[model samples]
Target: MNEAAGDGSSFSSKVIGIVFIILLLDLLGFTLILPLLPSILDHYAQAGDVTYQSLQSVVDWFRKAVGIPMEKKYNSVLFGGLIGSLFSLLQFLSSPVTGALSDRHGRRPLLILTTVGLAASYAVWAVSRSFIMFLLFRVIGGICKGNVSLCTAIVADLPCPKARNRGMAMIGVAFSLGFTVGPLMGAYFAVSSKTTGNVFYETPALLALTFSVIDIFVIWMMLPETLPKVIKGSSSHGGDSMDLLSPVSLFHFTAVTRTKEPPSKERMQKLQVLGLVYFCYLFLFSGLEFTLSFLTHQRFKFTSMQQGKMFFFVGVIMALIQGGYARRIKPGQHIRAVYMAIMMLIPAFILIGLSWNIAMLYIGLALYSFAAAIVVPCLSTLVADHGSANQKGTVMGILRSLGALARAFGPVVSSSVYWIAGAQTCFLITSASFVIPLFLLSKAQRSKEE
Candidate 1:
């Protein structure tokens, strides 16, 4: 029995190691386009493609409706925000369904399916010659991006909260490494294309496709079905009941209870509160994050290479914090760490908003990266601890879906604010908005205590 237990433990460890690599590769591909969004949009606009013009006309109408100006700088930023929001909106629609399906079928198959879909999306992107083609790429990519949520569910499947926390931290580290390296690679391609006169944006897209193919093969070969067969059979009925279109059903994880073993009221409340906190926080954070490249380009005239360097700095800081601090957080300490991280965001955004020079921006980003590194992992750990074994995938999916919803709207709203009011105002408002989630988090903690 002892030897058998040891083998199982060893296998779980191996699973986690592979999960880390998959996430790293997945995110590496996903983020390669981040630093290039502004340039890409500009290229489409200048190409005068019929689809680009059609979209531009609608944007023009919206600007007229809202009295936003026709400044070229703001135009690209707005387009970028729209593209970002579209990608996230698809994610919002798909995450819960994917999560519920994974609950029924198992994680390994879902991972493989999603990775394959992602590879197809990248292939489309590599050959995209028009704006509509690129838009289709985003659509497919977003629908398949539920891999991250599935990855988190895998962590929650581990034996204990401590193990789950460490696993979440590893996810964070993967994100850090991906973001750190991906943009740099993209920027290099961008520069090379300028000199080589290669097809614009083809190289980065091809590279992302390469990563997706590798990820698919890895999961097929190495990732065991983390969700057990018994759980899969039991949850099969509830899977079909998941209503993707109903926000209420999604947030409440209604399908999770169909198995006749609902979570306790207390646990349900905790999940609700955590989901809200995640949504609220990401709503604000993602908008600012999505716009950062545009802000730097407009304010500081940062080229693609410079934007890559900036993300590299942020990614390095985040990886260090996750590897050194976040992974070690004890079970009960998650809430406190969450509190501290959210509080840090207040100053971080303020400093970023107030930045006139690069030094001030980097200083704020240091704090931002620290907070970003810890909060999601800690919150995920807390949520994982609260979820019953059968409902882990559903719960994590609900949380990620909420985040996707926030991200879908956040960029559009923030970019509108940035376009009409300006970046300083947008940043200042977002800084103050952090209080909403913090207040909600504190209330949740108090209820948990009581």
Candidate 2:
């Protein structure tokens, strides 16, 4: 029995290790493309393709209605924002369903399937010759984007919240590493392609595909089913009752609340409040984040390589904070930590918005990276504490879904504001808007205390 216990511990360690490595690789692929998006859009636009012209016309009409200047750069940024929103929208639609399905079936199989789908998306991207084909690639990638939430659920399946918090921190580290290395590689390829006068983006696409394929194989070979069979059987209605198409049920997490053995009403309310807080936070954050590339390009004339270097800086700072500071945060102390992180962002964005030089920008980015490192991972840890063992997947899924929903609309709205009102105004307004989520989070905490 002692030997068996040791074996179980070993297996859990191995599983967590694999999860970390896989996420690191997957994020590397995901971030690799982010820095290149604006360039890709410009490529198609310059080609005078039908798809680009059609989209540009709609964007131009909107700009005219808003009385903004008719600059082509604005069109590309707005266009990129739309594409980013589309990806998030698909993720919003699919994440919960994927989570619910994983709950009903198991994590291993779902991981394999979704990873395969992601690989196929990258495959399409590798051969894409037109805006339409690239759009299809985003569609496919977004639909298969449930792997992150599933990994979170797996962490939640751990024996205790403390262990889960550490796991969440590990995941954050994976994100940090991925973001750090991916953009640099992307920038390198972009520079190389530009020098060669052929910028089709096949190399990065192929690299992403390779990572996805390796992830699929790793999950298939190594990841044990973290969800117990007893828990699996009970999740039969995991997310079945929640209307996938409806925002009402998805935000409220009816999938978890409506379960055969639901959490208490108070718990449900707390979860719902938490979900809203996450949505509001990401809604504000993602908008600014998605536009950062355009902001640097327009303000500082940052080339692809410069943009890559900028992200590398952010990623490194985020990783260090997650590893050195965030992981050490006590389990029940996450709410306090989250408060501190949220407070940090208010000034971070202000500095960023007001920056007249790279020094001020980096200062803001440092604060931004620190806050980013702490908040989401801490929130994930806190949320995991609320769910029962069986409801882990549904709970994590709904949270991710809410975040996805925020991401879907955040970029479009923020980008529109960006083009019309200018980056400084957009950043200032959004920075102040962070208060909304902070207030909501405080309310949730008070309710939890009550």
Candidate 2 lands at a TM-score of 0.96
Q: Per-residue lDDT of 1-450 in model 2, one digit per residue for the tens?
A: 111122255555666788898888788889888788888888898899898899888888877887778877777778988999999999988888888777778877888888888999999998898999999999999999888899988877766545566678899999899989999898888677667766548788888998898888888776778887766757654347545547898777777766677878898888888888889989999988999999998889988889899999999999899889999997567778888898999999989888899999999999999988988888888777776878888788888888999999999999988888888998999999988988988888788543
For candidate 1, the per-residue lDDT at 30 reads 93
Backbone-clash count (model 2): 0
Per-prediction TM-score to the true structure, in the order listed: 0.96, 0.96
Off by over 4 Å in 2: 1-8, 194-200, 236-241
Error of 1 at 427 (Å): 0.4
State the lDDT at 127 in candidate 2.
88
lDDT, each prediction: 0.84, 0.84
> What's the true lDDT of residue 273 in model 1?
83
Off by over 4 Å in 1: 1-7, 236-242
What clash count goes with each model?
A: 0, 0
Clashing pairs for predicted structure model 2, backbone only: none
Error of 1 at 106 (Å): 1.0
lDDT score of residue 38 within candidate 2: 82
